[model samples]
Target: MAVSTASPTGSFGPPPPTTAGAIVVEGLRKRYGSDGPEAVKGIDFSVAQGEIFGLLGPNGAGKTTTIGVITTRVRPTGGRVLVDGLDVTQDQVAVKLRLAIVPQRPNLDRSLSALENLTFHAAYFGFSRKARRERALELLEQVGLAGREDDRVDQYSGGMAQRLIIARALIHRPQILILDEPTTGLDPQSRLFLWDTMRDLQSRGTTLILTTHDMAEADQLCDRIAIVDHGEVIALDTPRGLRKLLPSEQGVEVVVVAAGDAGTGTGDPLEAVRSTPGVERADVVAEAEGRTTVRAYGAVDAGDLVDRLKRAGLELVELRQLEGSLEDVFVHLTGRELR
Candidate 1:
């Protein structure tokens, strides 16, 4: 169904065929009240056509608010959002018709059966009875819920319910799909199931915008990720590209017998580690069972680190490369982990 008419800033016309990208945000900003804190502080980014873009950030970082604005559920206090070159403020109805949103929480009717919910949502898009039935059945089978169509939504498992929600969102065959924390609380099996569904959609040339706290999920699915913190894009790159931002880009964990064993009796182990070849920085990260675990960052050389440890009279209990990851980059840039 069409959304409420928008003000003059929005448009009622169709988009041109040669738009540069699927979605673009220029200096987007949002604040609750006259004196309220700015939830989004003028962030800019863009999603290419048929690309899976991710928004990764901690809670209250304005990820949800940004999605809400692009989906036209919330209005921006400043800046502009364009979907298919259609300004969100000026083309509310046209933009709404082009995109579908699967929110963080499922909003299906508890009283309605799965089939009922899909068909009901289809009706809002002006589908005929026969069309709704065909569309509902097709989506049900596509989402692997063909046999559970008559069951009440409340009876479905968390994963099953989420699948139904996705099916409902696709009832109108939107060009863009926005998923907010789509796999936040699913079991491994369910998570993988939903991932396959998402991959299928992308293969069919659907543009996807995703927001999630799961770094691994983002790494696995997103073609590029924008890390937002305090309403800013702190980092924007592919998973591998983001990992390269970490200092040292490579690391190794060394377990020493004692702090003093890795240096002079009164010297600092961290200092000794830093002085080692290829060791950019080293810090004692853990202590347990009379052993000290030091993580050395940089392009760590195992042989060099081991030789240095031996020269300091330190016994190397273990040495292994520490893989860099998106999470490392997130913590590095945000100064705090995703809560």
Candidate 2:
């Protein structure tokens, strides 16, 4: 295990009364549409101290359902949610104050400028006008949105709008922050920028729980990740530990060099690669324009397989071994690509 790391723990605000272990959920369950169809069917997990917890899954995998229940946005069919040791259902008001959620969709007021968006959010949290302004400015600057503070949300780019949403979430300095698919559909640059912002927030002792289908995002940010698939957590561990479960597979992706729509190469490369040494499986295949490419699963050091292909004279023009990643484990467990 690569022993995950996160924000500082063990320091508190003055005595035995300060917050500890920001969020906790036990035997969480929720279902919709009746007895036959279940959204979340009895899952249990915990976020410790100041660590970043990742809730990962495909679309409609009970991630949003679990989050909604924990954040008090929706009532659960069963199971109790607690924040800072307070039952969410019983101490709804207190729990609400200590939590902040950045929704997957933008809810910013179009009429308000970026700064005004944040200010209005703080006002909803009941911050005084002056305090709201101070907090809004500080948060905007922290998220790299200070320069465009006066621009209306409609005028802002997708990245900019996302940044503003984060600032809005922080308006009250909540004990825990929840981000639901914070960077989906973002350009690469914007995605990286948001990741940096997430790191900054973690460094400042903000415990974060994020829901993302992006393996890279979960691997890079989560202290530990729980892989959700079809309404169940298929696996849970540190990113490295999760990959170790699949034994560090060397993924092979080939882009063929071809001249025409039809050509022959050993009948079928997919079948050939499946029989190669150290190969666990080979699933992805595409044939177009005299080219045949495949995505294969194999343990590290599959050079022998390459040598075998060379001996068989399979015109292998391109080959690169991708290092094992969380995506590999996800595929191994769920039998589907994360994307």
Give each model's whole-structure lDDT: 0.82, 0.74
| The best candidate in terms of TM-score | 1
Every model: Cα RMSD to truth = 8.0, 8.2
Best by lDDT: 1
How high is the lDDT of residue 114 in model 2? Answer: 89
Model 1 TM-score (2 dp): 0.76
Stretches of candidate 2 above 4 Å error? 1-19, 33-36, 247-323, 337-339
The CA-based lDDT of model 2 is what?
0.74
Sliding window of 10 residues with minimal summed lDDT for model 1 = 1-10
